[model samples]
Target: MSVLRMQGIEKQFSGVPALKSVSFEVKAGEVHALLGANGAGKSTLMKILTGAYQADGGTISIDGRQVSIQSPQDAKALGIQCVYQEVDTALIPYLSVAENILLDRLVQSKGAGLIRWQQLYAESEELLRGFGFSIPVRMTVEECSLSEKQLILIARATVQKAKFVIFDEPTAPLSTKECERLFQIIDQLKKAGVGIIYISHRLPEIFEICDRITIMRDGQHVITTETARTNMDEVIGHMLGKSFAEEFPKAHVPIGETLLEVTGAKGGKVRHADLSVREGEIVGVVGLVGAGKTELARLLFGADEAEAGEIRLKGAQLRICSPKDAVDAGIVLVPEERRKEGIFVEESVKNNLSVATIAKWSPLGFIRSGLEAGQAKELVQRLGVKTADISQLVGFLSGGNQQKVAIGKWLDTDASVFMFDEPTKGVDIGAKSDIYRLIGKLVEQRKGVLYFSCEFQEVIGIADRILVMFEGQIVKELDREQATQELIMYYASGGE
Candidate 1:
């Protein structure tokens, strides 16, 4: 039986249709996946259902009863809770774990008409223990790791007793081991008659967790089918309106002379590193949380200081004390957090695109808005960045589209050596394949690129060679042809 049904939902933003006649139904205890590229109307549809946006046309029926959800509280009262892609920010940082969990329903004392902190703490600890999670109950939100924070978020939601839970990109910040734990928790929830709406760009995860899958493209519902009835290729086929074979292209371009060489460099979580990457080749850096992969990029780009070491580029010793020095030398680092580090939020897509190479385009000692606008517009179309206007504020864009803006910044600058740290993180599956092709394009231009990813599968797909980092050191390096998940896991977990 259908527990929730949404029919002919229609929404528009500034006279532009965001969702057109979209419809779907979720059965009790089913994990229904909502799929789409960035700006593909998935967010809009959810906003309508959760009362963030009032639909212009459509009917939402819960258990065959017509209802009007005018606010988030209405949705919650109807047993609806949303866990968006950026769920971390939804938490209160100053609150303790127990306080955050039982926020409003803290057990109260009767006689004194006062709040009961002790009762809240004891009940919260028991609630967490029900799930076998042993996290510190008194710890503040700021003290928890990303994985801990995610688990706590889920726990808090499940405790709400919501019959329908919407999880958006819950695995983005979790480790593989932690992800396994979450799947286990979801299984328990399913047994308890809870329905889940899992939204993620990870195709494999949809297969692993979802009972039914719904594909959306360009703000329209493509199709909804059973997990066993469709293959990955067919799903990708529907997403792009055609086939995208070889999603991860292995560049066979000849490896040029060594373009980057580092010896004994130590910064952040990185220590005593000696490594080199050749021009026109892709080297992947793989590691778990706090493994120093990102810190290595920071040191190389001069965002973080080196405790001791020398870096030589093209056989010439270079002193890169800051990001400007590195960029002037034709090296670029695309940081992991696109929303925070990649671009300015309030700026136009055009301005953000030109930020890296603004000095070159402004060599006449004045800004060239015309040249900047043209270049930004061209790059957006070339990179398939979906935006109605190139002059739109980047903060209004989706996660995947925003990432393309970050990549466009470097492409505009024509950076030769690119460091891509989680370039495809938080992006939909469709955009990931596109970014992979862009990486191939960079290598075709003889640009040396170093890629870092938590997903070992992605490393195998793109890297010519894989360097595994653990505890601030490169413990293992394997040519792509020789690497395997078992091997990568062995190195990552200190098995080898």
Candidate 2:
């Protein structure tokens, strides 16, 4: 029987249609995978159903009763719970794990005279144990890793005994082991008759757990089909709105002399490292979270200094004591957490775009407003960033649009060797293709880009040389032709 169904769902923002006549159904004891590129309107539709956003048109039915949901409480009361894309969507960082888990519904005395901490902690522990989670219930929320927080969120919805659960890219930041644990938990939930709306970019998890799959494009439903009948390429084609043809366009560019080389580096959490990124070559670094990938990038970028090592740019050994030193040496890193470290949310897009190249644009602390605005506008148009005005607050833009601004910031800097960490994270499919095209353009300019992502397909599809890292070590190296998803995952999981 269908636990929940959405028919003719329609929504828009500022006259821009987000979802147009989308329909889907989730059945009890079944995992329904929602597939779409970033900004494809999957999250928007779910937000409407959860009362976070109001639908301009549609009918949502729960077990045959048509209902109107106007807020999260309404959705929760109707037995619909959502674990959003950002795992800590509603979590308080400073609060204890138990407190966060039972935030508003804390067990209290005298109808809210005071929260019963002991009972809450004990119940939280019981809930975690019920879901086979091993973490201490009394620990602070900030103490848990990204995956642990996700597991806790899943546990929260499952413990609520909700009729349907919607998970949005819950495994994007999880380690391989943590992902396996989450899959097991999902299986347990399914056995208990809880319908799952599993949303993820990772295809393997879709194949592993989903009973049926629904593909969405441009906020409209394309098709919903049986998991057993559909192939991966067909699903991908539907998500991208095109068939997969030469996913990675790796051209045989004439690689020049080594541009930057890191020799025997030891600093921060990263150990001895020997790597080189050359002109006109995309060298990809692949590793599980906390396998020293980010740390290595930090050391290379001089965001953190190496305790013992040497960095060479153009055959000259240089000491990178700060980010400016690295930038002066023609090295730049487009960070993984673009929101935290990248664009200024409060500033205008044009200001954020020109901040990186203020010296080059002015040279003497003088304002060249016209030059900056023109450059920002040009970059925005080229990257296909969706925005009404350049002066609009970046905080208000979609994740993918914000990412374009972040990348555009660096493009204005004119750095040759670029290190991008999860360059496509949270970017929509249309924007992702734009980024793919942008990366291709970078290669054509004979510039080097070091791309790192947990997504195997991205690395396999982009890099000229792929280096697989495991436990803070490079385990395997494959050329573009030799690299495949299975081979990369094998090396990533320490397999054959």
Candidate 3:
């Protein structure tokens, strides 16, 4: 029997339909996959199922009985739990891992009495150990990395004895080894007869683990089929509504003289790193999590102070002590964590776009609103940022649009060297293409670019050269023609 079912589910936001007449089901012990592009309504449907958003029209059934769920508590009461894509918002930063994991159970067990800290710690430790997680129970959630937080959420769901669990892009932040561990946990959950709804853009993972697949496009369901019956090509065509010619649209640009060079740079996790980027070139940096890719970017961008290094731009040495110093030296970084580090969430799109160049629009300590608005409007059109108005809060935009704003903020400056850390991490395929084209444009303008990502395919597709880092060092450097997935992976995994 099917453990969960939804019929004619519909949802809308600000008069725009997010999900239309969507029907879905999951049987006991089944790993069901949900596939879609950004803005394809997959998240909206799951939000409704979790009671985070009420559907405009729909009927939900659990165990063949109709039910009404109006809030997250109601959904939990019916044995439904969700691990959303944005992990930071899902967890409380100030609380310890154990407290966050057993919060619900602790309240229930208390029954108006004092709490039992000893039992809670013991239970939380045992639960984590069972899942192969070694995180300390008393460690604050704020101190944990993104992957650790993801595992914590999964452990919490498992402990809740959820009959139905929804995992939304759970592997986006995980390394290969970490992903293998997650798959193992999922295997255990499946053996326990939990109906799972898995959502992801990574096609290979769906084939490897999912039993069935459901494709959605433009707020509508397109197809639902057994995984063994359909191939990647068929699935991609269904999700996109057409055949995709190439996964990566690489552009050719002539390489020029060196624009930026680093020698013996050491900061944070990065140790004795050396690299160079020439004008009209895109140099890709590929590494696993904790391999020091982000640390190198931060050192170059002056987000972290370098203890020992020589940084040169066009044969001129630079002393960059902070982000302001880096910007003044004609360098900028588009950070990986867009929501937390890159954007002013509560501000307007225009304000965000003009943030880096606000001083340029101010004359004699007076702000020139007209000039700022004009620049923001031009960037919005050039970057194809879809928004109702420039005054709209940036927090309300979709992931793709938000990323565009993050990159656009840097365009208003005169910086000639650009560094992007996981620029397309959570974006969809179409948006990723857009970002690639933008990078190509930067190269065509004779700007030097450093692109860092964990995905080898992205490094191979967009870069003129690829540098593999392992254990905080550049272990191998390969030209565009010589780099491949296997070769990059070998060096990225510390191969000699």
Best by lDDT: 3
| Residue 148 in candidate 3, Cα distance off native in Å | 0.9
Best by TM-score: 3
Model 3 Cα shift for residue 443 (angstroms)? 0.7
lDDT of 3: 0.90
What is the lDDT for 253 in model 1? 88
lDDT of 1 by residue, 283-371 (tens): 99998877888889999999998888898888889899999999988889888877768988889899898888788679778988888
* Model 1: number of backbone collisions: 0
For model 1, what is the C-alpha lDDT against the true structure? 0.85
Candidate 2 yields a Cα-based lDDT of 0.81
For residue 443, what is the lDDT in candidate 1?
88
Q: Per lDDT, what order, best first?
A: 3, 1, 2
Worst 10 residues of 2 by lDDT: 103-112
lDDT of 3 at 462: 89
In the range 1-496, model 3's lDDT, one tens digit per residue, is 6579999999877787778999999987999998887667887788889888899998999988999989999999999998777788888899999998987876687668888788888999999998888999999999998889998899888899999999988998899988999999999989999999999878899999999999999889999999999999998888778887787877787889999999999988888789999999999999999899988999999999899999999999999999999999999999988998999989999999999999999989888999999999999999988676899899877677889999999986899999999999878676787899888889989999999899999889889999999999999999989999999989998898
Tens-digit lDDT track of model 2 for 1-496: 6579999999887787888999999999999998887567787888888898999998999888999999999999988987766655467878888877776576433475777678988999998887667888888888887667877787778777788999987887777787887888888878988899998766777998899999988778999999999988889888887876765556567888788887788886776677888888889898778777888888888898679988888899998999999888888888876766777888988888888888767857788888888988998898887776788788667677888888888885668888888887666555677777777777778888888888788887778888887766667888888998888888878875
**Each candidate: what lDDT?**
0.85, 0.81, 0.90
Model 2: colliding residue pairs: 38-428, 38-429
Winner by lDDT between candidate 3 and candidate 2: 3
